[model samples]
Target: MSTTHQPTPATARPVGPPTKHQLAVMIWVAVFPTLTVLNLALGDWLGTLTPVVRTFVLATIAVPIVIYGLMPQLHKLRVRLLSRA
Candidate 1:
């Protein structure tokens, strides 16, 4: 009896880390929705603050949600998408 090992298909290989451009695109995609929701939910309250304060508040709120919440899901989605293609 002989045993032969076949190489895995490309699609079966583990996906690599995202490139800088991919990361940038993911960030942009994450930010657009985050901003939209934040604006709708807090536009009136945030409007009360000065521009700098408003930006700071938005960044504070949006960054974590994007980095921790949205980004991982997006990365998974990206991996699924690339694997299909």
Candidate 2:
């Protein structure tokens, strides 16, 4: 008996990393809402910190949410949209 392998369909394939412009857009999309929420949630607490420290704190909170949370969902959306076309 012989077996033949079939190529995967485009819709079933994994998407690649974003291009530079796409990455810029993703960062813009992710960062804006992250910063807004962080500011609303911790504005008073962060006010006493130095500017650098405040920036660091905001990044620490935002990076994980963007990288692990928001980026993945956006990527899935991108894949879905592209597959539909």
Candidate 3:
């Protein structure tokens, strides 16, 4: 006798790491707010620098905060949420 394969249901929870598109969204979600808040808080101080220098400084600071500080927390949240499914 032959067996038939069944497709996963639409509501099925996904396993494994996020897809490329999902990762992009997660990065954007982490980066936008961090950059906005930093820019608002440091606007006056950063104003003295040229555009390129300002961008460089912002990126340098933002990268660490996003990667080290925020990404871990976000990943935890994702895992918790997915686990509930």
Candidate 4:
């Protein structure tokens, strides 16, 4: 049996780390819509809490959503976009 190893294609290779600006843009894209929707949906309930408590709640909720949920999707999008370029 013969084994042949072909070079990896561009699409097969993993993308490098994002630049600072790219990371910032990705984070902003993920965070803005998330915070906006969360605020709109929870505004009435959150408004009843003190300012600090409301902020704390929002951050707690937003952090998980941004980190675990939206960020992964955003990273995938970034990779796809870069690959297409």
RMSD of each: 5.1, 6.5, 7.5, 5.6
Global CA lDDT computed for model 2: 0.86
24-49: candidate 3 lDDT, tens digit per residue:
98899999999999999999999999
Best by lDDT: 1
For model 3, the superposed segments whose C-alpha errors exceed 4 Å read 1-14
For candidate 3, report its TM-score. Answer: 0.78
User: Per-residue alpha-carbon lDDT of model 2 for 8-85, expressed as tens digits?
Assistant: 585366667778998798789988998999999999999999999999999999999999999988888877775555
In every candidate, how many clashes are there?
0, 0, 0, 0
Q: Per-candidate TM vs. native?
A: 0.82, 0.78, 0.78, 0.82
Model 4 lDDT, full chain set: 0.90
Model 4 per-residue lDDT at 58 = 94
Ranking by lDDT: 1, 4, 3, 2
How well is each residue in 1-85 modelled by candidate 4, as lDDT tens digits? 8786543585367789899999999899989998899999999999999999999999999999999999898889989887656
Q: How many Å off is the CA of 19 in candidate 2?
A: 1.9
What digit string (tens of lDDT, one per residue) describes model 1 on residues 1-85? 7786543584377789999999999999999999999999999999999999999999999999999999999999999887765
Q: What is the lDDT of candidate 3?
A: 0.87
